[model samples]
Structures are given as structure tokens and as C-alpha cells.
Target: MIIELKSLDEIDPCEFAYYANDPNINTYLRNSFPAPYTLDHALSFITHSLQHHALDFAIVVDGKCVGCVGVTFQKDIFLKNAEIGYWLNSQYWGKGIMSQVIKMLCSYLFSNYTIHKICADVFAENKASCIVLEKNGFIQEGYRREHIYKDGCYHDLILYALWRNSDEY
Candidate 1:
């Protein structure tokens, strides 16, 4: 299948909401990603992405927007770092789409920005995500026990990091 990264503005909010409405997709994601995602939520998110000129991009598969990958830039003394995040439609899982998407986004970030490190915080139970990060040369740097509160319960968090010098990147 063809996979590409496209600007969020190029995606239809209805399509985005349709794929993101699945509760299963939000299990490991931050609470900010709403359950039963609506078209309005997609519009708001796309607007914010456009306004900030953010590094966010739509994960396009076979010309259809299937998901997104982006980074949150750090500031102050941490200005050289960015926290990466991503999600894919469950239908696309295990097909290696996310691993490729992460690599593409990381390469773009490294080449276009002055950031030296890309990091990710994952719920400890999300083995698939951790594996994807590892495939992209992200090393687990820390593990915070019960650091995430989701769905009314605490979950462990795994911190992974990749440096600009990583040969794979």
C-alpha cells in the first residue's frame, strides 16, 4: 500500500472523525484525544495545527487519511527536544505503517529543526507502540510507575528517546 504524509489541511474532517471515533484507538493516547471523536473535534484540531504551522501531518494510506503523527516542541532549557506522538486506524495496525510513519516524521523533524532529541511517552501496556519506537531506534530511557491516569485508573509510563546521531535516523 502507498503511504504518505500530508498536511492536515488536505484531509476531510469527516473522514478523520470517522476513523478516530473508535474507542480502541484512544486506549494508549492522551485523554485529549476524545472518545467518540466528532467532526467538530477534528476541525478544531486541524485549525490549531494550521494556525501553529505545527509539524503534524496526516498519515495517508492509499490516498486516504488514516491517522496522524506529530511532535510537541519543548521550550526553556529543553528547547532542543521534541516529544513525538502518533496513532493509526486499527485496520492499519501490524502492517508496519506506524513504524514507517514514525521514521518519516523523525527524519523530517531532524532535518528541518534544530532539535537534537525526539522522545515518546507510552503507556507501559502498549507493547505495540514500544516496539514501533524501538524499530525506529528509540531507546527506553525511563519507566515511571503509575504515572498515567487514564479511564479512571493509573498506568505505568515508558519514556523512550532517540538522538539525532542515531545511525538509523
Candidate 2:
């Protein structure tokens, strides 16, 4: 089970769309990740990724592009902060794939960029995602009550973080 983080260019839009169309996978993701995910959405996302290769990556498992991991850098006063996010194909879940992917992404960000802290906003109900972040040395920093309004309901949001100087990494 070779897991790799590669540029989105390595995959076609269809292959990306095929794996990303899972509604379950999108539940924990941001609202920007549309449901009924289409080829056009994949193509658009790929195009956007092409311009921000430094921040986004396609998660490849045994040569198949099955998911993605990325960080969004904050601007102005928070330039050193980046918010991390990821999603994996359900078929590829529970194999510790995301744990490795998060480590790879953190290493890349800390080594290549001026990032000081990397944080993740996870839905409180998503224990699996929270575990992946904890495995990568991210500590729970805060919990916002009813912070995420998704699927016509409010969901709690848990904030987790890892600093570049943290020994846990």
C-alpha cells in the first residue's frame, strides 16, 4: 500500500471525480465541496489546484488518485497560519493512509514555507478525522458550539493545531 502525495496534474478529472463523488466523504468537508460532484467541478478544482500546487495535493494510493489534502494560508496579519483539510475515498479509509498524508503535508509546509502553525477545523462528530489529526501531533485548541451550518443543521466544530516547533512532530 504505497501512499503518495502528488500534484493534481497527475490525475484526470474523471478519476478525481469518480472517487470524490461520495456523499459520505463530503459530509465532513466544507460547503465548497459540492455534492453530486461532477466532472466540471473536478475540472474546475484541478484548474484551481494547478495554480496552487504548493498548497494542495492529490493523495495517491498504489497509483490511484483517491483523495486530497491541502492547506489554506491566511493573509495579512495571520500570514504564518494555515488551515489544513483533507478527505479520502471511503474504500481507502481506516488503513492509516490519512495519518501518513497529514505528516507528509506538515513536513512539506514547515520545510518549504514560512508557516508557523497548521490547524484543522473538524466537525465534532467526525471522530476519525480528529484521530488522524491527533496522530499527526495536532492538539485540540478550541471547540466552537454550532459553528458549522451544514445540511440545514448546525454542527459543532473542533479546532486542532500543531506548531512548527512542536516536538511531537
Candidate 3:
């Protein structure tokens, strides 16, 4: 399937919200994504993402948005690095769409941004996400025990990172 990453305006927010708000889709995500997500939440997210100049995009496949991904820069000691986050509609999982979109986005970040490293955190139970990161060349840095609380339980997180080097980028 063809993949395209575009600005939030290029997508229909209602359609995106419908897929994203599904409990099945949000299960693996952070607690910030509320259950029974509303249009207001989607609008707020779109507005915030735009205003923050976040490198966010609607992951489109065959002309329909199937997911979302973004890279957020960190300042201070992490000034040279950026954190990556992504989520796909449950219906589209296992289709390799996210992998393709992530690879393209990572290439764009390395080529365009001043950042030297890209990092991500995945809940330890999210094995599929870890696989995607590994397949894209991110090294498993370490695991954070009970780092986040979600759904009434503490979850361990696995940190993964990839550095920009002439041979890799």
C-alpha cells in the first residue's frame, strides 16, 4: 500500500477520531488518550500540535488516514535528540503500514532536522512496537522498571534509540 504523511489539515478529523478513539486502538497508548475520546480532544490535539511546531502527520494509506506519528524535540541536556511517538488504527495493525511510515519519517528527520538522535519508549508488553523499532535499526538501550502507571497497574518501559551516522543515515 502507498503511504503518505501529511499535515493534520489534510485529514478529516472526524474520521481520524473515530478510529483513534476505539478502546482497542488506545489500549497500548499512554493514559493521556482518554477512553471515549471526543471531537474536542481531537481538535485540541490538532491545534496543539500545530502551534508547537511538532513534526506531526497523518499517516495516509491509499488516500485514507490510517495512523499518526510525530517527533518532538527535547531541550536542555537532550537538545540534540528528539523523541518519536506513533499509533495506528487497530484495523490496520499487522499490515506493515506503520513500519513503512516510520522509516520514511525517520529518514526525513535525519535529513532535515538538526537532531543527532531519535529515541522512543515502548511499554514492555508491547512486543509488536519493539519489533518495529528493531526492524528499523533502533537499538534497545535499557528497560525502565515500573516507569508508568496505566489502567490501574504499573508498566515497564523499554527505551530504544538510533543515532545519526554517515553509514546509517
Encode model 3's per-residue lDDT on 63-104: one tens digit a residue: 887779988899999899999999888888998887787789
| Each model's lDDT | 0.91, 0.90, 0.86
lDDT of 2 by residue, 51-169 (tens): 76557888999989999887799999999999988999899889999999998889988988888999899999999999998988999999999999998999999999999989954
Q: Which residue pairs clash within candidate 2? A: none
Worst 10 residues of 2 by lDDT: 48-57
List pairs with backbone clashes in candidate 1.
Answer: none
State model 1's lDDT. Answer: 0.91
Question: Who wins the lDDT comparison?
Answer: 1
The alpha-carbon RMSD values of the candidates against the true structure, listed in the order shown, are: 0.9, 1.2, 1.3
- What shift in Å separates residue 98 of candidate 1 from its native position after superposition? 0.3
Q: Model 2, residue 19: displacement in angstroms?
A: 0.3
Instruction: State, as a TM-score between 0 and 1, how close model 2 is to the true structure.
Output: 0.96
TM of each candidate vs. truth: 0.97, 0.96, 0.95
Q: What TM-score, to 2 decimals, does candidate 3 have?
A: 0.95
Q: List the residue pairs that clash in candidate 3.
A: none
Comparing candidate 1 with candidate 3, which one achieves the higher TM-score? 1
